[model samples]
Target: MNQAVPAPTVSPLRPTDTRSTAPTRMPWLSLAILAAMGFILVAAETMPAGLLPVIAADLQTSEGVVGQFISVWALGTVVVTIPALALTRGFRRKPLILTAILGLIVANSVTAMSGDVVTALVSRFFAGAFTGVVWGMLAAYGRRISPPARGGLALSIVSIGAPAGFALGTPLGATLGTAFDWRWAFIGLTLLAIIVFALIAFVVSDAPGQAASARLPLRRVFLLPGVAIVLAVILVWMLAHNTIYTYIAPYLRATGTGIGPDLLLLVYGLASIGGIGITAVLIDRVPRGLLHGSVALFVIAGTVLLLAHSSAPAVIAAAAVWGLTFGGASAQLQSALTLAGREHSDVANSFLPVAFNLAIFAAGILGAVLLQSADGLVLPIVMIALGAVAFTLTIVGRRTAFLPRR
Candidate 1:
């Protein structure tokens, strides 16, 4: 096996840290701040799903039209992430991150103040544009600042925000909107962003950006061994995951189980939290095995759903399995790319969110088409097929992508 490439030397921003490139202890305080940033971004992006009815009514629009806010945000991310990362590659990490958080705050604030759908949708676009910058850099940033030996743990800690946002943040935003007003959710997100900005400015350690001479071109980064394969898995896996997720309500309604989409998502989200926890503990020990097991279990879960859609207990059980499989995916994929991209990890990581949002965009269209043309039960069948393909890619990528850590 080829040896892992060494990370590029990062110039420490502080005077006392010049003696060693790596920190002696895990940077919990710094990791937590980054996690907070992730939480805010994910929460801000998905909050609209939970408040769609109210937002639609307030804007005098249909729920379908209001739903486009999420899609537009994703489109903005998909369109901007690669170019934004390339353009800002030379900027210092701390300031760049702070700027992204500030953009989110402003965007969310504007969204909250907007009385018209056009204005709200425009704000969502900017929110997603800024989010592209954030997610593109965040995992790499987490890795850059942590103890060298515990990189996986740092990633897991930072990544908790995503699942937590999906599980806790979105639901809480819904509750707040239901109890008060939909605008309040955006207002609340703005407040949280403010606090995160302050924390990141004060608490997080700064890492220097890639030197111009050391930076890899975007094309080179994409072609790097394992980078493309990892991204392929992400695209396929997430496309399957999001298709069912986006249309989960209609899918559940078709199962004849009388389960509410809200309850099902709650079940999935809580289970996702557990999955990430397990990934953190086992990632370093069995990275390849963990990835294989997660995807394999996902296929099994899909099979159960396909066969037993009418059984409420079986449906809920499968959802939990699905969540568990998906929860650790971000960390696993990012870690693989970090390894694959090596010195060019940050540039490579930029593609991560692009692949994700593309899947999201495609899922929206695909789910709609499927619902129009076929039965909702076909959704699980798609999941099974895609899950199998994702697993196959992982196996085929063993040499390049999921190589055993040195």
Candidate 2:
């Protein structure tokens, strides 16, 4: 019998090796630092919304015109997310993240220095473009760095940063804008962005090499049946939520509510935090269908407030409920998208922000139009219709379970 040739010994470091030995666990300090970076980035992006009225007054423009700043920022993100993902595919994570942070730094700095509405809008557009890249990379990095079992939790932690930013940034921006000027808010954001840039640059590293075949396939992402339905849910939900949120200050003033803008921001922010916390607990335990059903209750509550706009307390309470449910729905929808495109999680994840921003743009335009139309009655009605759409889609989508069994 011919002697069998001894198999060549394979080096563990070989590119063909499929097994990942284990990623060296970073200290919690590093994780916290990364999370803080995420917080600052998101805060800078959203802080303008809270300061919109102040900016509008200073710039001598209508609130509706000021609202376009938000739409433009979101539109930038909507247009950039996918292309950014593709461009950065082969790039190292650390450098790309650093570049994004730097972009925020520049964007915020420019926004703070802007002398007119046009310059501010341009700065915001650039800020959102960078934000899109940061968000896409952050999600992809979160999944890569985490162990399989902890992936959802890791993403959740990352997701929480955005809402946390929203929660904190709004009140902070409003208070600062009230005390000083709107430009100061952007200045504060610029300083924060610089700090986050330094932290990320110093702490994080590139992810381990992935299998070449494991790269996200856009074709597969589009082919998933649940993608479009889930996108619709996200679009409608965001449109409804932002329709109210975008003009909340004006709405309160119109209703003759004594609650100041700062107070409203505080209430909305806190409610959002509560919602996020509750959803974090329920997402894994409760079925998606039921979780969405529960969120629908808050939408109804919001509708009730719109109808019964007489009581200040009731309206505030409804806003709180809306914040809670809206926050939870956002998280659930993101998780759903991730599950829907298990094979192309990054590509699917990219769509969430894209859909979210696009919806925001649509909502702002429509809300502005409604506000200009017959005595804002159309606003509430449109919100109710959006809530109905969300509820109906959740029910219809529930029948087809596309997500993998946990």
Candidate 3:
């Protein structure tokens, strides 16, 4: 049985009552800030992907070596997420959050100024840890402020930031690097981090709940009847999606698809954000049905890609559908996890980022291996197979302990 954790305790945001401690009754501003933080950090994480050549040139390293350095960011987050959260469990939420944002600022600034690869990798490692801590806390932070009945909606609102960051960040890094230098991209991250910091300082609640106080034992947390199944659903779904997504560019290039891959990516990103919009409207009203409908999009998209991978328009349409489903599905799963964990939502929430990042890493490696061994045709089939299986599991398990107790 899950033990209940108290909803967030409201604390004074400021030492003095000079300004509003939060966004005040509306909380929309605060929500936007959280969303922007998501966007900024995703962008920061992806900057290397966009500006690799420029970074390699300035640092006098091979592009291949620079590409390999992505491990510094990935590995850093993977290692630090749990430990950082565990160590900082007792701090005030708002300031710790800002400090996390500050950590990003320092990371990016150090990266921008690094004269050698060692300095840059160290900076990125710090950035990853900072971003990981924030991500670990993000869902709790979002849910804590939400009116219980509208928790899903609030989560969806904040969740929109990831796709938005990808949609904007991929291009922003290239634009800044091409116009000035790669360092400008890091500078951009720093600037955005500062702005997000200001928003957190001014708008987010001075909530007093330290993270670890309510966290349940990880093993026991998953031992709740439906939690593991739902996590399986999430893992397969994420792995399936990332498998195709990580390799879309190469697939398009090889196939000579009539559409521009970059354009399709932007569309995919926008559609993902659109999916979040769909969730915002429907999650609280018909939560289970909404999840079923969203998962079905994956099945449909996978089938389309399987049958018509060569049709540029079909591929494009499939990508949009993919984004829509993925964008919405993430928040929906978070909702489901919250319910599945019963009163121990904090423990459940912490599992999300860890699962998501692992899926990305594992699936990307697996997908790349497949691409090298087989062909583009095989990737979507794997996606379809995984998606179909996940759909079946979710549908069959809908009425199980996975859902919210009404």
The most accurate candidate by TM-score is 2
Off-target runs (Cα >4 Å) in candidate 1 are 1-25, 51-64, 144-153, 178-180, 374-376, 404-406
Residue-level lDDT of model 2, residues 252-355, one tens digit each, is 66666676767777877888788778877777777574456655775686777677776778777876777677656667887888787776766787788888
- What C-alpha lDDT does candidate 1 achieve relative to the native structure? 0.82
TM-score per candidate, chains pooled: 0.86, 0.89, 0.80
Rank order (by lDDT, best first): 1, 2, 3
Residue 72, model 2: lDDT of: 75
lDDT of 1 by residue, 273-377 (tens): 888888888787889999999999999999998899999999999999998888888878877887898877767877988998888777766776777777779
Give the poorly placed runs of model 3, Cα more than 4 Å off: 1-26, 46-72, 110-123, 143-156, 166-168, 171-186, 211-215, 374-377, 401-406
* Structure candidate 2, residue pairs in collision: none
Each prediction's total of clashing residue pairs, residues at least 3 apart in sequence or on different chains, is 0, 0, 0
lDDT of 3 by residue, 199-318 (tens): 788878765554344556677887887787778888888778766665654556555576654566667777877887887788778877777777788889888887887788888899
Worst 10 residues of 3 by lDDT: 15-24
Say which prediction, candidate 2 or candidate 3, comes out ahead on TM-score: 2
TM-score for candidate 1, please give it. 0.86
Candidate 1 vs 3: which has more TM-score: 1
Local distance difference test, candidate 3: 0.72
